[model samples]
Every structure is written in structure tokens, then in C-alpha cells.
Target chain A: MSTIPEDLSYTKEHEWVAGLDDGRTVTVGVTAYAAEQLGDVVYVQVPEVGAAVTAGDAVGEVESTKSVSDIFAPVTGEVVEVNAAVVDDPSLVNSDPYGEGWLFRVQIGEEPEDLLTSAEYTSLTTAES
Target chain B: MSRSTPLREVHEALGATLTDFAGWLMPLRYGSESVEHNAVRTAAGLFDLSHMGEIFVTGPQAGEALDYALVGWLSALDTGRARYTMIVDGNGHVLDDLIVYRLAPEEFLVVANAGNYPMVARELTERAGSYDARVEDRSESFALVAVQGPKSAEILAKLTEADLDGLKYYAGLPATVAGFEALIARTGYTGEDGFELFVRNEDAVPLWNALSEAGAGLGLLPAGLSARDTLRLEAGMPLYGNELTEEQTPFDAGLGRVVRLDKPGDFVGRAALAERAAQPDQEDGPGADALRLVGLVARGRRVPRHGYPVTRDGVVVGEVTSGAPSQSLGKPIAMAYVSRSAVEAGGLTVDIRGSHEPVDVVDLPFYRRSK
Candidate 1:
């Protein structure tokens, strides 16, 4: 089982959104459950910083040994930062999906919609598994 | 629900990610697939290959019957030796690539891929009806476990007294491994010195456990199909569904070496293969002449996965059959069939999604084990 951080909000596509202290910026990464399901991630492609993305847009991709999955944007926002560390070592996504493996930081444009709480996300993951 | 192998519980106990492969629920990976792939190259990796088919051809004229049933001249094959051969249809279209072990003067063990074994068994039965041979599907009665790597010999030597040092590649023998009856063969898909142990279905778990305990200090990890695939890709070996298929002949896949045209005696696909061989080069023709299997080394991080288009300039010239990030080479390598002209012209690129990633033409078997 993977850890579902109580402080973070999750999307149906298995991305976690961490609201920053500034309230305008939020860090996003694949949930640990998603990372675990993907096995060993060999490569990660993230959207360019400063690019505007709409909610549900496939902003990036995570390639594992067996398959690949699109990393979708949970909310409409401008990409503020991308994690070069995860790009350099894709295994970090499997190791620390919520912390050091955070894929990108987005400056919120419109308020996030329909994000699931930790309890709800846990239920979703449990049901899927 | 997909069928489970005898070692299914063992995989679940180890937290393996299971997937349906050829209708069998097999382990795709355990933890990190990269780690397992690297282990096979550097140390050792255990594989549960019970899902593979084990068909027995035995009787007074088994070898003669096999000679007619398969492309190889099996009657001449020495007992205890295994030959890498293929079974093709009447049109020379490959059915499945196989490894046939001549166990005795009148008995052979035919190991077929999981998905195609049933068809192979049926084909063998039909083809051998005129000869004094019997084909039996013993897949359910047997289990296969392979220990592959540089350290495989030493690890296996500790358990059995069966002269691991003298067991030549592609040879098998009946032996007692950890007190269990097993037919240990020095063969594997991974390009490493290894042994594949064939045991009874009930002995699968015990054999795996004994090997695991013995291989622990030697860095043997339980590798799954995901790593197995990458390792074979690095070795430039073809998978049944990807590279070799019923739609293509051996010559089309550049695996004509396994087809024994010189072998005396009429075999299945012999006539069609001979006709194809005698024909003039079809350089301008669309069939067989257009595609030639070749290796591609990506210049970038993006991998050239199966079915990705291979192009030169702007025209699509070929398609990738198998590809992966090679742990040994530290770059993505692939086996693709490119047009002979595009191959000679030299600027080949694989369309990675929408981005055209430049790939340098290279030789197959990206990694070879040191003898």
C-alpha cells in the first residue's frame, strides 16, 4: 500500500495537488499509488515552465518499463517550475512521489474543481485496486 | 479470470505486479524492473517461466517425425542437445519459434511460447499422424524456472552436483537439483550464462525457494516478464508476437538461419521457403523485399517502443518490433525492420510519439555476455 498524505488533494487521474502557503502556487505530482502501479519509472516528461495549461490537459507523460501514462493537469494554471531532479532520476517518482518527486509547480489561474480529499482518494484507490 | 501459474501465490507473496500474458496471470515485475534487469546482467535473476509450454514428442520414430513436423533436421540432432528452431505453416509463415531438446534417441521435449503452444501441439499432432510419434501437451504437468546471469553457474553449482561448468550452452540433462528431479538446461532468453530447470508442477515453489536461498548472497533477484522483455530486447532476440508472427516468414524477420534448407527430407514450409529463397531480390517490390530487420540506437532519452514508425527524411520506412532503455548501454536500443534503401542511406529516425528522434543504425545483440 502507498501513503495518501492527508494535507494534499487528489485527482481521478492519480495526481496529488499540494496547496502552497502562498495560496497562489501549488505543487503537483503523481500519487504514490499511481507511481507504484507504474513500476519503475524510466523517464518523465513535464510541460515547460511558463506554459499555460487547462484542467484535464495532458501536460506531461511518465514512462515506465512496461507502459506509459499521461500526467494530466488537475486545474487551469501556468506552469511555474518543473522538477529537473525527477527528470534526472526518474526512480524518485517511485520512491518519493509526494515529496522530492513532485513533478511541477503551477501558479493557480482559476480555483481547482472536483478535487478529492484524502479520504475520498483513499476510497477511490482502494476500489480500483 | 486469467489462468494462474503454479507459482502464482509465490508472486503475490513477493508483492509482484501481475498481468495477463497469453491468458496466464504472470508477474510483470517486482519493485523496480530496472534493478531486476541490471541484476541479470551483473549477478543473477530468477524467473518463473511455468507459463511456457512443454510438449513431448516420443515414440519409435519421434526424431524422424520431428524432422517432418519442424524445419530442422531433428533426426540428426544428438541426444541431450537442444536446437533453436521454428515451426511454420505450409506457406512458410512462422507459427512459433521453439527450442527442441533431443532428450533421447526417440524422445524430444519441445518448448513453445505460452500463447502459441496449443496451436503448435495441434499442428504437431496433425503432421505426425503418418509417422510413429505421439505429441502430448505436458505444460500443466511441468513448471519451468530459469536462473540467469553471470553468477548463475556458481549459484546453481552449490545446489546440484551436475557439473555446471561442463554443461554447454543449449544442452540439457536429467538431474537431481536440491534433491528434486529436474531437467536442467543451459538456456535462457536473457543474454547471459544460465540454466532453465524443468520440474513437476508441485515442486515449483520448493525449487524457487531453494534457488532463492542459494542465490541470495550472489545478488539474484526475482525478475519478472517486464525485465525479461528488456533483456531480450537488448540481446536483439525476437518475441513471438512482436518480431516473429504468423503473417511473416523466417526470411522476412531476418531469422533465416534457423530455417534448415540444407536438411534432407521434406518438412513443413520447405517448399514455400525454397521458392522464396530462389526468387530474385524484390528490392522494388512491396512484399518481403521492403522490410529488413535492423537495430536502432536512439540519440535521445525517449525510447522507440513497439509499433512506432521508423522513418527516413519524411517518409515512413519501417516500424519498431521491440525496444527498451538498455541498462548496459545507458541508451535506448531497438529492433526495427527498415527498408533496405533507408538502411543503406543511413539517416533513420523513429517517430517517438510526434517527435522524430534520430536513431543511428546499429547491429543487433546490443549486449553480449563475456564467454
Candidate 2:
């Protein structure tokens, strides 16, 4: 079973939002369930820092050996930082999806309300699997 | 619902990620596909190829029927030997690529792609109307398993009494494997030394278990279609739907040599293929003025996928048929059909999404194993 940390919020697109409790900046990465489905990640294209993104916008892409998927923005925000480590070695997304595989951080523009709690995210992943 | 192979339960037990392929449920991968691909290159990889279609042609005139049905001169093929050939429509467009194995004096087994076998069987039956031959589709009752890599021979030696040293490439012989009656064919698509075992569907699970047990010490792992695709791509083999289609002739894919124009009798697409063969020679080969298949290695990390346009100077000159991150080459490679003039002009790039990624044109087959 894929791990769903109780402290983070998630979107239906399978991205997890961390540090949302602080109400200012939040780190985002694809969930463990999404990583498992994607097999091996070979390339990662993250949004540039300082770019404004609306919720549900496809801001980046995650490419694997078999297929490619869009990285949707979980909330409306301006990109604060992008992970350069994952860009250099994409396998980190498969090996450590939650900790070091974070894609980017965003400075929130408005409070997000549609993100799912950990329990809801668990149910969604369970249904998919 | 998709059809399940005989080893469906085995794949499920191994925690493989299953995907629908050509109306059959097949394992895409058990773990990391790259690891599986590497295993096949360095050691050995087992593959459940039961999804491929097996059509048997038998009787005194089987050779004549196949010669008329396919491009190659099957009648000239000796028993126990196999030849790669293709079936084309009346217009000379490739219907499907096939491997014809002569099992006996009057019997031949034609292995075809899963998606095109039904049509191939129907076409063969129709074409053999005047000949004393019988075509049978035995795909539902037969199971195919392959062991591929440098260590394949060592692993298979433990199971069968067949003369491993005597068996040549593209040869098949009946043998008892793990106490099961099987036709061991020294053939594979992974560009490695290997053997493909054809057995009854009921014997699949036990045979797989026995091979797995025997090969456990030789670093053998169960590979999936995902790995198989990359392996064949690195070997520069043309896939059915990707590199070949009903709209393209074998000449278009640089495989015109498979068409035997000098055969005594007239075969299907004979006149059209002869016309193509009569065309004036070009720098590369026949049909150089038309779109020619070429290999592309990407300079950037972003992979170029199927259906992506091959561009030069912002103009679409060709299209990518197959592309993947090659484990053997340590780079992203692809097969695309570029126009002859564009190939001569140089400066090729694949339009990956919106960005034009520069690519180098190289010879087909990005990887070859050392003997």
C-alpha cells in the first residue's frame, strides 16, 4: 500500500501539499501511489521559480520509461523554489517520493479549500489500485 | 474484458503491473522496467510470449501456399529452419511481419503479431484455396516462453536434453523440457542468444515454474512487455503498429530484402514489389526518394515519444514511430521515417511537445552484444 502522511493534504491528480498548516508557503510533490504507477521516472520538468500558477493548471511534466504525465498545480500560488536535485537525478522521485523528491514550493496567493485530507486521499488511491 | 494468458495468475502473484495490450492482459513490468531490461542484456530474462499468435500450415502443398501468402520463398526453406518474412496486401502494403518455421516436410508454423494474426489466418486460408494446404490458428491452445541473454544457454541446459551446441540461430527442434513436450526454437527478439519454447497451454504454469527454479541461480528474472519493447527498440527491430502499418510497404521500412523477387512462381503483391525493385537505385537503397526509416538519438533528457513530429528548420519532415530511454545506450533513442531530402539536408530535431530537441542521426541498432 502507498503511504499517505496524515499531516499533508492531496489533490485528485495525486500531488501532495505539505506545510499547508503554516498558511504561507507549501511544498508539493507527487504522492507515493502516483510514483508506483509511473514505474521509473527518467526526466522531470518543473515550473520555473516565480511563475504564477492557478489551481489545476498543468505546470510541469513527469516522464517515465513507458509514459508521461502532467504535474498539476494543487493550489493557486507563485512558485518560490524548484528542486534542482530531482532534475539532475530523476530516480529520486521513485526512490524517495515524499522526502527528497519534492518538486517545487509555492507562495500561496489565496487560501485553498478543495484539497483532500489524508483520509480522503487514502480512499482515492485505494479505489484506483 | 480483455483475454488472459495461461500465466496470468503467475504474473499477478509476482505483483506485476498488468496492462491491456492488443486485447490481451499482459504484464507491463514486475519491478523497475530498466532493471528488467538490464537483466536481459547482462544475464537472462524470462518472457511469457503466449500472447503472440501461432498459425500452423500443414499438408503437402504448405510451402507453396506460404510462398503465395507471404513475401519470402518459403518453399526454399529447409525443415527445422526459420525465416523472417512479411505478408503484404495486393497493393504491396505490409499487412503483418511473420516468422515462418518449417517443422516438418509438410508442416510450417507461422508466428504473427497478436493484433494481426486473425487477419493473417483469414488471408492465408483465402489465398490457399487452390492449393492442397490447411491453415489452422493454434494460438488459443499454445503457449510460448522465452529465455534471453548471455546466460540463457547455461540456464536452459539444466532443463532440456536438446543439443544446445548443435542448435543454430533460427532453428527449432522438438525436445522434452521439464518433462513437457515442447518445440525449442533458438529465436528471440531481444538481440541476445536465447531460446523460445512452444508448449501446450495446459503445460505453461508448471513449465514456467520449472524454468524459474532451474534458472534461479543464473540471475534470471521474469521480464515484461515494457522491457521487451525497449530491448527490441535497441536492436532496431520494427514493431507492427509503430514502425510498420498497412499503409507502408516493406520497402518503406528498409526491409525490402525480405521480399524475394526472384522466386519462380508469382506471389501476392509480386507485380507491385517487382516494380519497386525495378526502381533506380539511390544512395542508401531502393526507395530513397520516399520517406526512409532512420534512427535518432536525443541530445536532451526529455524523451521523444510516438507520434511526435521529426522536424528540420521548424518544418515537419518525418514522424517518430518508436522512442524510449534506452538502458543500453544510456540515451534516449527513436526510430523515425524522415524524407530523403531532409536526411540529406541534416539538422534534425524531434518536436518533443512544443520544444524542438536536437537529435543526431545514427545507424539502426543502437546496441549489439559482443560474441
Candidate 3:
């Protein structure tokens, strides 16, 4: 039912991490599956740029017409930038979750390791009932 | 533990995203909230209302018992007729708002909200302790399905043997639908030509399938809670948590007419309502430029959200109660309580987010189709 893009890795929290490299920045956003579940995106509490975040720490929040959900950090890094375009147009998250819907870009802190690959994430999501 | 309705499997098969509503796992939406909402307005929609509670009361003095318990005098209602009434406690606070259906001279069925089922049942039982009537909760054994929209009757007419044409507004009758016995009530909350069918849960599967098959030509899609809210909002109906609450008096909720102070016998909240209505000053009184319930036709594309500030003459008059981009109306429409005295000129400006936008105040029932 939910489509997982092949180029990005995933977290158990349903967030997607794109690209790699120890020092290069990687983009992070919610999966299509998560966006479809939350009906009508209304507001997104944008995270502070240049703030450090660790894995499992909350990055920001996304408020839908019905509820508000917290976005978590998939890996430890510094948030370099946030998508202001999506903040102005919340529906973009529902439309292009991977491209224009990228929530934020984080400067990779150290060696990127133990991240679930596209195949692994696919199987991980598939194994879920 | 929470419970799932009979249409749970059916919703999952249709790829509906489920949500927990009042301890019931119900479908929040299918493809899109707006699409499902528009489908109910333009065509037809089938909703599973099985989570609501249906309680039957029958005895020699059932009418008297109901009149004592309910805010409405049930004895006055004729057979096959239904009336919306309120249930209040001794302090006049609203316990629940429900519809009482009279089936016979001494038999009445009270349909209550799902979350307030136990509370209503328990309260009724406590009061019925001194009465000759009996209360039995038939919620679990029965399932209610709502078929609402302009094309509802046409599709339903083809499936049932009962003469639906003879059934008028607020009237109900016994009928066989989809080869199962059901109480067919020609009433709905969607403000459309609709029917509420009460059938045994065991027979719900067949009935749902039959209705779906019969409704295919009518373009009836299984609607979820999202559509239900938009439809009810357009109809000027109030949700319990939003417009109606325990702290709010009935008159404040725009339901003052339902309370009958002149009627004989002392029902709960009647005296307090009378005293409050007779008070020299009422908060709900037509104060000069005081905020009242009015429809706001947005000047721009920005859809107003609840709690948004309503500004008139650079002063905050009220806040938005409900708002959305209406699919049928083709614009950003909203309802807010604006100061009646201050907003006498009609057009009021709403401070949407950070932008100041002019809004016009109009009477409710925003979208009504000429029959």
C-alpha cells in the first residue's frame, strides 16, 4: 500500500533519510505512508536551523487538520536548513514527500553506520502487520 | 480494550486509515479527507454508525417515565415519530443530546452517542428505579448504518419492499433490508435526504454488501468521519466537544427552543433554564456588537482554522469555531462567533494567521439545495 523510494533509507518511526558521506549533508523527510495517514496537513513547526539533534530526539512537529505529530531525528547531526517552502505550503508534504517535501537537511556528524537500507526498510515495513 | 465496528474489515479492504474515536477503531478517511467529504455532498455516502448506542424502554408508563427523564415530553410524540431532545442533570448542565423515537404507546427507543452510552444508560436506570418502565441497552446487538445524500432514497428504494415514499421526515418504520429485519428511520445528521438502518450485527455484513452493490449506481462511496464533520458543519449542526459541552447552557448552544418551560411537570434543568432566561442580563443576549454565530465567506484563499482571531474595526470580536475549503461552495468558508452588536454592518475582518482579511457574516445552513 505504501511506496518506499529505493534511494532512501528508513527508520522505525517512518522517517526517510536520503544520501550518505561522513561529512556531507543528508536530507530527511517523512515517508509517503506517514503523510497519507495524517489527514490534511495544516501547520509544520519548523525546527531551528543550525541546531544539533541526536537520534530519537524530536526535531519538530507537523500539525494536521485532525492532529499534531512530532518529527524525530533519525541520526545524530546538525540541522543546517529547513524547507520553508513546505512550511508556506503544507500540502507539498502530501504531494511530493521525497522532493519538495524534504523536511530538513542535516550535516552528517560522523561515520554513517547501522542505517536501514532501502531493501532492509522495505522488508522491515513489509514484515509489520 | 477498544472495539471495532462491523464495517471494520470492509474499511480495511478499501484502504481506509483508521483512527481511535471514543474507544472505537473507526476509519478517519480513505483516499483524501476532502474527496470523501465532497462525495457525501454531491452523491451518496454510507457511514457505519454502529458505535452509537440504542436503548429501548418499554412499560405501561414508559411515556411518563421518559417525560420525567428526558428534556422533551415523550408522551406527546405520536407513533413512528422522532424528536430531538436533551438530557440534563439536576444542576441544568447538559448530560447528553439525543433523539427519542416512539414506536408504540408505551415503547420508545433512545439513540445516544457512543461515548455517553454507559452514562445515559446508568442515569436512566437510576431514574427508572422508581418508574414502571424498563431500560435495556441494545447497542452491542444492533448496528446502525447511515445512507445520506440526495440520491440516498433512490438507491434505497430499489432494495427495500417498504414504501419509502410514504415515510416522511422524522418518521420510522419496520422493514426488511437486504433480507434482514431492520428498523428503517428516515432521519440523518448529514442534512440530506437520508435513512438510518438498525440491523443485527450478525446480519451487518450481508446488509453492507447489499447496500454497496445497490448503491454503486448512485455513486455511493463509504464515507468516514471526515466527510461527516464537513457535512454536519455545512448543515449548521454542532459537534459535542466543539459547540456543545457540559459547561455551556442549552441556550448558549443555540438549542433554547428545545427546552419547554411552560410544560407541566418539573423536568431537570427547566426551572434553571427559566430563571436564566428570565434573568435581567444574559450572556447570550443581543449585546451591542457582541460576537454571534455567523458564516464567514473568506475574501482570499486562506482557510480559517479554529481559535483564529476574528477582528472587526481592528478589535478582536470572536474566534473561528469551524472552517474549511468547501468543496461544494468552491471557496474558503468558515463559521465564527462574532459580536452581534459590533458586527451589525455584516462584513467583519478576520485576523487569519498574520493577515487581515475581510469576512462577511451570513446566516447558517451555508449550503442548502432546493428540493
Best by lDDT: 2
Question: After TM-score superposition, what is the CA distance of residue B286 in candidate 2 from its true location, in Å?
Answer: 7.1
Native contacts recovered, each model: 0.71, 0.94, 0.18
Highest-scoring model, TM-score: 2
For the predicted complex of model 1, DockQ is 0.79
Per-residue C-alpha lDDT of model 1 across residues B1-371, encoded as one tens digit per residue: 89998999999999999999999999999878999999999999999999999999999999988989998888899999999999999999999999999999989999999999999999999999999999999998999999999999999998898987778999999999998999999999999989999999999999999999999999999999999999999888899999998888888887777778898889999999888776566212245337888889999888899999998887899999888888889988899888888888888889988889999988777988888
Clashing pairs in 1: none
TM-score of chain A of each: 0.97, 0.98, 0.88
What does DockQ give for each predicted structure? 0.79, 0.94, 0.21
Cα shift from native, residue B320, model 3 (Å): 4.4
Writing each residue's lDDT as its tens digit, candidate 2 over B241-354 gives 999998787888889899998888989999988877777652234544578899999999989889999999999999999999999888899999898888888999999999
What DockQ class does candidate 3 belong to? Answer: incorrect
> How should the candidates be ordered by TM-score, best one leading?
2, 1, 3
| A1-129 per-residue lDDT for model 1 (tens digits) | 898999999999999999854689999999999998998888999999999999999999998877789999998999999999999999899989988999999999998888899999999999998
Candidate 2 C-alpha error for residue A68, in Å: 0.8
